[model samples]
Target chain A: MALTDRCDIFGSVHEKGINRIVRHLMRQRPSLFNYGTAFFLRNPNLLCERIQAAPEVLQAHDPLLSVQDPVPILGAAIPLGLNWCLQFTDLQIDFHPGNVFHLPNELGNLPAQRLALRMRGCFGLDCPSEEFIREILPQVEAEEVAQRGKEVFGTKERQPAAPEREPIVLPTRKLQCLCVELFAVLHFEWGTIPGNPQQWLKLRLDGLEIVDLGPAPLEEMAECYIRAVLKLGILPRLSVPIEAMVLNITELMRKQGLAIGETITLQPTPVPAGVPNNPAVEDDRLKAFINLVVEV
Target chain B: MAHFTLAVSEGTFRRSFDLLKRNLRFSKSDQASFGIFVAGYDVRAHLEGGTLDLRADNTISVRELDIRWDRLRFTLGINIPEICVGGGCINMPWPIPDICLPRVCVFSGNPDISISPDLAAFVAQEVSFTGRVVARYFDASVPPPLPDLCAPIRIEPLPDHNQWHIHIDPQTIDVDLFDFPDIVGNLIENTLSNAVRAIIPGGFVRDIILAIIGGIADFIRFLLDIPDEIDEWLSDLFNVSFGLLDFIGTLVLDFFSTCNPIYRIDDPFELLPASNGLIPVRIPLRNLSVRVNDAEMVAEVDIGG
Candidate 1:
């Protein structure tokens, strides 16, 4: 989710609150939520069942959501898993897990209005009793967390020492699967990219990426290109051609609206080798795809 | 000099073997069973997949068998799986730690429990072994003149078992109704002929001569326990000299005028009655396939390569 939405939904926890949480989690988990991670399994407030119901929720005439509305309530269901199913309340949940994030392409419209089909290992949720976590939390609880906070500051052994284990600070995440906070807004509109004149363009912001479906109207006789994303419950074992994924993203954007006048300069990420550049090489092998985006 | 009569067709021959295999149970009364294992008195697990080294002072009979042929598929895609025949002698030597150590000290005579031994004389017989060959027709393209289930030839145990021999009796076949002896004889002859041709082509030109030469090669190779590497090497040179003899034999079979002015060389039955004049090549020719009538053993046999 976008930082603002993440902050609001996480109870007005602004960038400062997030920084504090991250620092605390890092102190607890170490390096994981810090720079060591290439991916982050966010468990932020969502349920597996609700994620499954999201497609129907949107098709039922989506309600216009304000910038502050919780993402799952705004006709867009942010995918989450059951394991690491943390909850401030029954409604507020977190699916983030040990140090990992998905690739932007793998996000598969989880931030879009559709079913949250997973393309990775199922964050299998056994839902350990809250009583269990609470019981384990107090066992051998220590005082004073020897961390940078104490060493950097002059406050020596004062009052009740912070638990020996630092108040958890998530490890530094060097990279992310999706644009975690790259975008500014969370609304969508159909527009036109001048280059692709005949196709209607779709531009959406989940406060992370400015997702654009290319300007395309199949033919004068065809219906609007209907696209949906689904998540599988397991980590997908797929060998994908990055080139195909890139082409797919570009094509989707072109159809939505080649209407954006400004050039969208995208960075070139390295594509793994042996994945055939030709999509047709594996056109029918959808099972091999760990995650997928279907556009009808 | 001797003719033997034994009647068992290929189908009956195979069925008998199968029934015997299924019925034969390992006998506990067999002394070779528990002799050597008790002697080990200090091995954990026992009786696993390994060789049994049978050694004696005067002589050592060792079989470093690395395999059981149950999984080995034959060229004909037939498999007569390996079944434990029986060959272990377990003997425990007494005296050891009275407790756990001694119990473990005794060789694990169980098949599931593995036992390791450096040198065991009366090595506990775990499982016995038997050799088998999956018999399949060489060629199926040609329609069988008679029902294949009733193979004219039956398994006849040879009187002189040490030399290792099998009798191919085709007399039981219907000479008129089916005319299968001709085909059976041809299969045997052609198989021999091919073996000769493979050994030294142009050496055995005529079928009869080829059969004679092939038989000699078989006796020298298999019956006498000669290595094929040496047999093959000798055959190349041996065939040249034998080739001259083969040519002369063919001439005799064709001209000797003992049975008739001329006899058809098409079927083996044709050569049967003419055994009277086979005085010269008789001993050798019959080695490939022979018919001898003596008071004790009246038989027609082939010493297989």
Candidate 2:
């Protein structure tokens, strides 16, 4: 389908659409102090096809919130997994990055809101208990995330003697389908050159490089333009012209006895070659950042 | 005395083998401290399109391995615009070989693995690994698969069974200068004179061919043996090591330690009294063996008291 056709379908979700969903959610839940219209719509391109309810929508709507407020609130709802994209977008939220907002009545009341709150916490929250969190987030664990983060992004100074949280014990079968996605945006900087300088852009997964796009002229240095679609599944496919490298990782996962819900942190970096491996030099020549997104 | 034995079926073995074959991919690298260039070149080889079999005779073999590299090559520093398309280093005159490899096949005897006292940990059996080099040249005019290059090179695995270690002894590896087809040899001799091949005494093209073939074999050995290294490390770390004097002292100490046991359990021949007001028991270990079959590995222990 054409791009506009897809947008229109989502655009026609309602006369008010996502905006209305967000305002209604705000009026219903007072704990959800902040949210946006786009928050509920992931793959804005697929806007109408898959409309997700926001976390606040899943929370208990305090009728008091609507009555206590002087101004009328709008409506919107985002699905649980939608929180993953928040780190990449300009949309703002009051909560800290990677923190899951849960219902205060999560454990006490055990209502339908508990399931919604649990699902949200499963994907994004670093909640305290595993038994409660595992109900919705079957594939990933917060402790594992923290441990993996320390191992991948840790420095000697940053390394801790022990983990601050308890490690989640995982069964063998679920560990077999471990998958992780790494998203990186590399900014290129040329020294005094006006036009796009030629350089190789390399993306290495787990220290092994799967693709290198370069020797081609770069368009601009002002923005981070390079993005990678990491394909980690039973049958691994690295799309082309990069398709020359056809790798199937399912066997390796089995050999390592990886569980289905296990997380594999892919620490990949993209850089212009031949540059000195100095911090000062690299800071000037290029800057790279990464986000690790995982699923069961 | 007590003894036990276990058996495995061919079906289980095949299932395990298929699972292993499916998982043989180089998804990511364990070495990251290395630079991007090094890491990028560390490509993985998989039997993407191939057939394998495991026999009931306790043997596993791969009939074919259609290897394709996991990464595409693009010029890093070169600025020639003619070769640049969509910013990829293509259409270039220079041979920018894929760091890992291109498409190829392994046509050889069925390779097998066996566990025996006479062999080092693991070694390739009955298989003479031979590769068909398939390098894609951008220009159609360039005739592919030079005549002399058609010969399949030999890949040998020399095992150090006595030392309990195996090494890819490519030190004696050689390439026959006359083996190259005359046309192929002449082109390579002249073309490589100006490049990195210029440093080698013989034909540079010939050396590169040897290197590629040897490198592939070496990589296979690495893939097979890397897991063993972890076990070896663990065993070395835990297995006690002692100097000559320490060993003798320990032996004497153990002898003394065993003599003062409080009680004893004897065979029909004799009965001993408790010395330290506690009964001592002696259990005889008659035998221990690890037997591996097509489906399972059984560890049997025979004990007698």
Candidate 1, superposed: residue stretches over 4 Å from native: A1-162, A165-283, A286-296, B1-305
Candidate 2, residue B30: how far the Cα is off, in Å: 10
lDDT of each: 0.26, 0.27
Can you give the DockQ of every candidate in the order shown? 0.00, 0.01
**For residues A90-145, could you state the per-residue lDDT of candidate 2 as single tens digits?**
11111111122222321232221011111110111111245644663643455456
Give the per-residue lDDT digits (tens) of candidate 2, residues B1-305.
11333233334334444544454554443322222221222334343333334333333333323333343222222112122123233343458653432443332212111111311111111111111111111222334345523233312221122111111111111111121222233344334444545465577676776666555544554565454334333423443213353335434433332222222222211122223332222223233343333343333333332
What would the TM-scores of all predictions be? 0.16, 0.18
**Candidate 1, B134-186: lDDT as tens digits:** 11121224554455432433223112212212212111000011213222333
Q: For model 1, what is the error of residue B36's alpha carbon versus the real structure, in angstroms, after optimal superposition?
A: 28
User: Alpha-carbon error at A246 in model 1, in Å?
Assistant: 30
